[model samples]
Target: MRSLVLEDFGRLTLHHEEEPHPPAGCVAVAVAYSGICGTDIHGYTGSNGRRRSGQVMGHEASGVVLSTAADVVGVSIGDRVVINPLVGCGACGACLRGQAQQCPDQSVIGVTPSSPGAYADVVIVPAGNLVALPAALSLRLAALVEPLAVAVHAIELGRPQRGEVVAVLGGGPIGQSVVLALSVLEPQARVLISEPNADRRRLCTDLGALPFDPGSTGAGAPTDLVIDAVGHPATYAAALSTTRRGSRTVVIGLHSQQVTIDAFALTTGERSLHGSYCYTPTDLRRAVDVLTTRPQQAATLVSTVVSPEESAATFDWLASPAPPAGKVLICFTDTNEPVAAHR
Candidate 1:
C-alpha cells in the first residue's frame, strides 16, 4: 500500500506501507478517489495546528469495500461507498443528542493523527461510517459526499426560506458546495457569493449564484442568511454585519484569527449565529441523494483531478496564493474511465 505522508510543514512524501486489515465492526476500503479538502491545505501550511508530521491527511473519499468485519452488517464486500471521516463515541452527551460531530472524543480519520486517511490505496473505517453509494453515482463524484454534507449541514442550520436572500462568504470547495446545496434546498431563494478571486466568482455565477467581490462591494446589504465559509476575521465581521435583523448566520470556515462583533447590534436585532461542524449521518445521506439526482450540478464543482503521483505538487500549489479554483480530486487507480468535469 502507498500513502502520502506529511513529512513536515509544507512537505509531503510518498511512502509504501502494509495494507491494513479491518478491525471488529469496521471495514477496509480500497480507496479509489480522494478529494483534497481545504483543511488538508491548512494542514500542509501548518495553519490548522492539529495535523502533525508523518500524518496521512485526507477525509473526503470514495472507495470499494475490500472486506468487512464479522460484526459489520449493513456494509458488504465489493460495495461502493463514500467515507464519512468523523467518528464519535456513541455514549457521549453530544452523540446522545444526535450531534455526534460535537462529541468531545470525536476522531476524524484524515484530520486526527492516530487514524490514517484515505490518501492511500486502502483505509479502514467503522462500517457505520460508510454511506453506500447508488449505482448511478460514480466513484470520483462519490468522493464529494463528505464536503457536500458539510454544506448541507450548514444550510440546515441557516434554514433559508423561500424568497429569502442568502449570502455565502467564500468560493472554495466547501463554499461552492454551499452554493450548490442552497440552490437545491432553496431554489426560490436568491443566492449571493462573495469571493475575491475572479475565477471562483465566475464559477459561482455559473452555478446560479450571484458573485460579489468583497473588496469592491460589501456583502450585499444585510441578507436574510449569511454563511461565512471563509472563516477569516474579515469574513466573520462581514457575516455579522451583513445579516439582517432577526436573521441567521452560519460559520463553517476554519480559521484561527480572533473575531469581534458589535454586541449592541447582536442584542438589539435578535439575530442568531451558529457554528457548524461536520455533518451527521442524516446529512451525509442527503448529500448522496443530491449528488445522485443532480450529478451535473455536482460535477461542475470538480475543477481538477490528478493522480496520486501528482498529489504532492497539487498540495504545494494549493498552499500557494490564488491556487486554481474548485475541488482537486486524487485518483488512486490508474484507469481510463471518464470522470465528470466543469471545465
Candidate 2:
C-alpha cells in the first residue's frame, strides 16, 4: 500500500508499506479520491494542535469497498461509499441522538493518530462509518460528502427561513457547500458571502450568491442569519455585529481555538448562537441525498485532482497565501471513473 504520511510538521512523504488488514467489525476501502480540507492544511502546517507528526491525515473521502470482516454485514466488497470518519461510543447519549461530536469518547479516523485515514490506496475503518453512495454520483464528487455534511448540519441548526437575510463569512469549501445547501433549502433567502479573495468571491457569485468583500468595506447590513465559516476573533465579532436584535448564528469553522466574544452582543440582541461541529447521521444522509439529487452545484466544488506522488507540493501550495478557489482532491487510484452502479 502506498500512503502519504506526514513525516513531520510542514512535511508530507509518501511511503510504500504493506496493506493493512481489517480486524473484526471493520472494513477496508480502496480509496478513490480524498479531499484536502482547510483543517488538513492547518494540521500539515502545524497551526492546529490536533495533527501530529508521522500521521496519515485525511477525513473527507470516498471510495469502493475492498473487503469487510466477517461480522460486517451491511458493507461489502465493490460497494461505492463515502466515509463519515467520526466514531463515538454507541452507548453514549450523544451517539444515541446521532450527535457524535458532542460525545466525550468520540474520535475521528483521520484526525486521530491511532486510526490511519484515506490518504492511501486502502484505509481501514469500522463498518458503521461507511455511508454507501448512489449509483449516479461519481467517486470524485462523493469525496465531498463529508464536508457537505458539515454544511448541512450547520444549516439545520440555524433553521433559517425563506427570504431571510443570510450571510456566510468564509467562501471556502464549507461556505460554498452552505450556498448550495441554501439554494436547495431556502432559495428565497438573500445569500451574501463575505470573502476577500477575488477568485473565491467570484466562485461564490457563480454559485448564484452575492459577494460582499469585508476587506474593502465594513460588515454589511445586519442579517437575520449569519453562518461564520471562518472562526477567527474578527469573524466572530462580525457575526455578532451583523446580526439584528433577534437572529440565528451558526459557527462551522474550526480555524481558531478561542475567540474573545462580548457578553453584551448576545444579551443586547437576544441572538441565539450555536457551535456546529461534525454532522449527525441524519445530516450525513441529507448531504449524500443533496449530492445525488443536485449534481451540478455539488460538482462545481472540486477544483483540482492530483496523484499520491504530488502530496508534498500540494500540501505546501494549499498552505500558501493563495490556494485553489475550490476543493483540491488527491487521487489514490489510477481509475478515476464514476461509480455508475454498485451491487
Candidate 3:
C-alpha cells in the first residue's frame, strides 16, 4: 500500500507500506478520497502540536470496505462508508455521558501518531466509527462529512435563534461550512462572514453569506451570535466586540496565541462564550443527512481534487500566505475510474 507520511514540519513523503488487516470488531477500508483539512496543514507546518512526524495524517475520508472482521456487525464487506476519526476510551466519564468528543482519553485518528490515518491506500478502524453513505452520495463529497460535523457541533453550541443575525469570523473551509450549516439549520437567520481574502469572501457570498473585510467593516450593530472559526487573537477579539449584549459566541478554531479580553465589559454585557470541539455521533449522522440531501451546496465547497502523489505539492501550496480558498480532495484511486460503484 502507498501512504503519505509527514517526514517533518513542512515536509511530506510518499512511502510504500504493508497493507493493514482488520482487527476484531473492526474493518479495513480501501480509501477512495481523502480531504486535505486545515488541521492537516497546521500539522504539516508544526503550528498545531497534536500531530507529529512519521504519522499518516488525514481523517476526512470516504471509501469502500475491503474486508471486515467476523465480529463486526451492521457494516459488512463492500459497504461504502465515511470514517469518523475520533476514537474515545469507551469507559471514560465523557464517553459514558455520550460525549465521546470530549473524552479525556480521546485519540483522533490522523492526529495521534499511534493511529495511522486515511492518507493511504488502506486504513483500519473500529466498525463503530464507520457511517454508511447513501447510495446517491459520491465518495469525494462524503469525505467532507467530518468537517461538516464540526460545523454542526459549533452551531449546536452557539444555539442561534430564528430571525437573528449570525456572524462567522474566517472564511476558510470550516468557516464556510459554518455558514452553510447556518443556512440549513436556521434558514431565517442572516449569515455574515468576515474574511480577509477576496477569493474566500467571494466564495462566502456565493454560499449565501454576506462577506465583509473585518479591517474595513466599521463598528456597526452587533450581531446576535458570532462564531470565531479562525481561532486567532485578532479574530477572537473581533468575535467578542461584534457580538451583541446577551448573545453567544462560539470558538472552534485551534490557535496557540494568547488573547486578552475586557473582563469588565464581558461581565456587564451578560454575554456567553463557548469553545466547541469535535462532534458527537449524532452530529456526524446529521452531517451525513445534510450532505446527502444538499449535494449541490456541499459540492460547491470542494475547490479541487488531487492525487496522493500530488498531495505534498498541495500541502506546500496550502502553506503559502494566501492559498486557494476551498476544500482540496485527494483521490487515492485512479482518477478515470470510480473506486466504489454507487448503488
lDDT of 2 by residue, 127-217 (tens): 9988988888888889999998999989999998978989999999899999988888778999999888888888888888898754444
Two-way lDDT contest, 2 vs 3, winner: 2
- Name model 3 segments beyond 4 Å from true: 213-219, 335-343
Local distance difference test scores for all models: 0.86, 0.87, 0.87
Expressed as tens digits, the lDDT of each residue in 1-343 for candidate 1 is: 8999999999898898888888898988888899998888989989878899998999999988888777888776778889989999989898888788999999999899999999998898998889898889999889899999999999999999999999999988889999888878889999998988888888888889997655455535668998989787888777667778898989999774577777777779998879999999999999998888789988988989988889889998989886888999998864344222110
User: Which structure among the candidates has the greatest lDDT?
Assistant: 2
lDDT of 3 by residue, 219-249 (tens): 4567889898978888877776777789888
Instruction: Return the TM-score for candidate 1, rounded to 2 decimals.
Output: 0.94
TM-score of each: 0.94, 0.95, 0.95
* Candidate 3's TM-score: 0.95
Worst 10 residues of 1 by lDDT: 334-343
Q: What global local distance difference test value does model 3 have?
A: 0.87
Candidate 2 C-alpha error for residue 27, in Å: 0.5
